[model samples]
Target chain A: MNFSHIDLLSFKSSPSPQKPLTLAPWRKLLYIKQEYPDNYVDESFLENLQKNVNFQSFDYFALCRESTVITEHISSVLIFVAVFIQLYHDHLDPHLLVSLGSAFVFLGCIIWEWCLARPAPPMHKSFLKTAAVFFLTLLGLSPILRTLTQGISSDSIWAMSVCLFITNILFFDYSSDLTYSIQFPGSVALNAAVFACVLLASRLSTNLHAFGFMSFALEWFALFPIFRRYLKRIMPTGHLIQTLLLVAITFVLFWPISRAIAVLYMIAVFSLTFICPIWLIFIQRYKNEIHGPWDEARPKVHRFRSPQR
Target chain B: MPALNICLASDFFYPNTGGVEAHLYSLSQCLLRRGHKVIIITHAYGKRTGVRYLSDGLKVYYIPGLVIYNQATLPTVFGNFPIFRYIFIREQIQVIHGHGSLSPFCHEAILHARTMGLKACFTDHSLFGFADTGSIITNKMLKFTLSDIDHVICVSHTSKENTVLRAALNPLNVSAIPNAIVGSLLKPDPTAADPEWITIVVACRLVYRKGIDLLVAIIPRICHQYPRVKFIIGGDGPRRIDLEQMRESYVLQDRVELLGAVQAADIHKLLVRGNIFLNTSLTEAFCIGIVEAACCGLLVVTTKVGGVPEVLPEHIIKFAAPEEDDLVRAVSLAIETVHVRDQRPELDPFVLHETVKRMYSWMDVAVRTERVYYSIMKVEAPPLIERLRRYYGCGQWAGKLFCILAAIDFLLYLFLEWAFPRQNIEIAPRFDHKRYVEKAVWRH
Candidate 1:
């Protein structure tokens, strides 16, 4: 049996003008026999093919506006570091720093209260009570925290803090949705930041310094993020003002330490905030998402109809 | 054409029952009738191991391996190559055809066949989404396996389009060969229809993807709308509890019957008992069950999902959107057509049977598949460099990675050939085709 002969037979059996073979319309299936071959690709083969059907084109300016979340987070981390350096060098008095942090916490609470449309008295009372208890507990635990890493080497302490801080920065919830609750850096993120603060406080020489710094770190990591989130929701202009004020303060604090390092940091922060969104828009041109009838059908049930299992 | 030695490789086969397994078995049986020597290679299922022969003289070699979820072999890429190479040599196999995209054994066999310089073909039997993590990984693996494949076969046009996009293959290389049924076994029963009571039969795995949720939601409403309607659900899965609960809550034990896990042989008997077959599957590739239902002369009311719209003529099918209200409306309309104004929708079961028989048969699938084999065999095998060139266009980094893997696989093939020289392996005895021809003639 010759293979080429079978091929020729199949070809001859196909519909021709003289034979007047009836050709079925291509319904894109091989169940029904037709005049065409098995591999015949009709003109409408890819007629339903769609590319980037649901793609949303990004605007560079809007993207930049959205990226202020990252800028705010970076500035907050930098300010914490600047405060640590000032405390470590014994340049700023511990009492003054603690008083300043307490005043700001009070002011932020009032603003947070103002942001709510229907403020509940019990929630405000419970929040104040929780804050009072947290501060008192921190003051009592200062001596223990000050000596938490007394046996560890200074170099190891520094390395541990660096690792924890990096973990905190990496896992921070940066979603810009105002309704998204601030979960206190949530899970591993919060643990890592608290661990880093404890390590840094253990490096202080006295209990008062440890207590002041520990309280300030708690306010910065835990409380300030909630305030910033609500502040952004209630007043976008105030959020922008807050970001600018933080950036200027960070630059000034770093200036006293090293002018060159501060200048490079400012340049890096500005470029990241401005240029990254543009790069994202540039790469959006290459996104190719193909959808067709071949994809799975997502069933649309209008009402919540759960079976009584 | 001279009989060519062929091997059907997949993780799914006998000891396991599914659409793909049945397809492989039926196709191999038809190919055997055409005088081709065919053997199946699959991962062992429990006590079913080593070489075994079915009643039709079709040999299956079950290699021992780890079975993962859904009877798929764990994808140890290079682990199966040595044994595969040995079997290929002993059987003198010329073509390696693989079935099912999710079967790691099939993908591995295709990859190794390419390395050994043999013609390779793949059949995709499922549709996958592009948004999910599992699909993304599976599509990447499919791309690697199909990068240098000789030909690809899909069960439907939607499946073909899906495979083409998933593997980035040339459309010309892929053929849409639908799954077929043993049409002779599914004879329509003339006494099955009742004018007063309409029975809607659904025989599929009771899973969420099979639209058991929609079935659960619509059953009570359907029963409420038409008091005489009956439902016969003939499969069981994790969703059986939900269905049973629905049956109890609605107090519909008399109208709705649940036959848990019916056998494949009984499917026709169950389908023939109903006037309509309701399939509410959210996603399907070809849906052979609906074809079987149609063969039993039942009007199919199925959701308009992947490849279903192309399955049957419009006269016998009522398409429904995969929504509760739409399905309820469609089923109600179908019931009305069957009961009240039953003129335009009424179809003669004999005509439907003839149409279905002419449209699909395993013998047709085998003939079309043999054509694919011949077309692939006519082209000379390309050089290794040329094969690498084809694989190099997979992705930016994936291209180079695939090239390296292909090169390594080629080297491994050379090593295996050197270690277990093919000339030394004993050849398996081929089945006598004259006896099969005599038996076929006697049976017919």
Candidate 2:
């Protein structure tokens, strides 16, 4: 036996034979309206879509596939060049840079400890024990790191350092999690910087200079990401200023050819961000989600063996 | 009736044992029973290479290639094009039917077949999510592959909806064709021929998605209420550890048996041992297991998630929410219903036979598939325009793209004929005469 149902639509006004138009509540949202399988293109629909005063032409910018890799490499290259300039010019003492960086790292650590302490009153001793162990590990690792790459060449070391730094940036998850922080990037960045310093440490004339450079890298890469992330979350304006200041500082340090290249890179990066989102929106127009009774039904398992700990 | 040449393409083939493999096998046999020439194309498995026959005139070409993660061949679009072209031409393939979404092999087969000027049909057997990144990428890939296809076949109505949305295909181009079970494989176990002890069968990979977590929770409670009831759990996965923990905690050691990955040949025997076939899965499309269980003359107690409710009538199967408590209650009710009666209720054996006959059959699938092939082969604009009208409703952007792709594909077909003329290729003669005739008689 075949089972079928007939559907009837009740309207307040009588339908006309020619050029009859029946309009429902018109809204831009796609999901809410009664949908028909056969209604692909309504005759008056395009005309009404075109009539909207606010409708504007969408820009389709081409995305350079290698843009992300180029931007990351250029910025890191610029930062290293700036550090080298400071060291050669002797305007900023290597020892002094190292000391200041270490001080900042210590302060950041103290603040992190303070925040974590507030969550659990009885876990203060456990937190202190962890903090103590962390400090000790850093202290012990520094000496070993100083002599770690002594066997390797200066150029090879620099090359390795650059690769590791890039790897750290690429692998780091950039999802907008609740605990968004500069510190997250900063720590990995610092780790990469310290490895670079260790390679350059062998180039230093004295042990103290090597120690200073290593400390400087530790401070810059490790603590900076956390601070950056915290600042972005706590103060948006401050984060924007910091980003602008870094860009401006990078431009000034690079100068001449590098300066122009930096500006072009920034424009390219901004264009890339906008281009991707727009492309995604354009692609969304192709989203023909076909749902019916044929797809696998997700079972609703209600048995909770352990409802609570 | 003239026998039609049918080519079956899937990411999965023989030497592999799963629903898709069984589906391909049963379908080929069924189509052969209707006097259709069936050939299967699958990525080569270890030591299983070149063309081989599986019993009845059904030929399988185990095309040698790399098996990527989980038996799915490494998908290099256009890489499999040449070999596939050779196979299609050699076999005089009229209809190209691909199975499974995850198989790039299946997707590529459909695309190349379209480009080679053959009618292509895709059968989707699984459901996918739109929320995840992996699913998003897969969906986009599906759209690209499905852009120029003639028709799509899904196992259930829900699967049709999913494929339409996932690939952005026209709804009418898709059809709900549920999978079928071989009646001989499923029969109630004769050994545990007792009316007192109720045996509940749970067979599936013990995974999180399978709702094995809910199974672990409910089994103890079920065993508690009914002392005589015993559980036979089949298949194994990571969540088996948790099930073991639950088993130990509840101390229902002797009541439940973990068979652990029973072979395909043994599934029927394992299923027969149980009075109630329990499916605790949280989601499904058209569950072949439930149908097979029903075929075995066992009452089905399954969670009403996905397309399980639509698979069978309410009288034959008991429904429950995907939750643990509800499943426990539902199973209890099924057991209670079974006990109150002196003997098992007279379940219409014809229900399974009629359902399998009406909704499934390789000949029906092949005939419908052949129509799509004929439509693609026709050069005239009128029929092509009608097919385009069906595709033009997928989406605003997709409709235009699909139309353009289909038109371009048609042009490509004309070009390929000029480049590689069909007159140059030799067609192989039919495999057998007496057996083919005998098989057709057997089916009716």
Best prediction by DockQ: 1
Q: What TM-score does chain B get in every candidate?
A: 0.96, 0.85
Per-residue alpha-carbon lDDT of candidate 2 for residues B345-408, written as tens digits (9 for 90 to 100): 4554445434433434445444444444444444322356655664465568877876776666
- Model 2, which residues run further than 4 Å from truth? A1-190, A197-205, A216-309, B78-83, B189-196, B206-208, B220-227, B236-252, B341-426, B433-444
All candidates' lDDT scores?
Answer: 0.84, 0.66
What is candidate 2's TM-score against the reference?
0.68
In model 1, the runs with Cα more than 4 Å from the true position are A1-25, A96-105, A114-125, A144-146, A176-186, A303-309, B188-199, B206-208, B211-262, B269-275, B341-345, B348-351, B436-444
Clashing pairs in 1: none
Kept native contacts, as fractions per model, are 0.52, 0.22
Winner by TM-score: 1
**What's the TM-score of every candidate structure?**
0.89, 0.68
Which digits, one per residue and each the tens of the lDDT, describe model 1 over residues B251-303? 99998999999887888889888888999998899999888888888888999
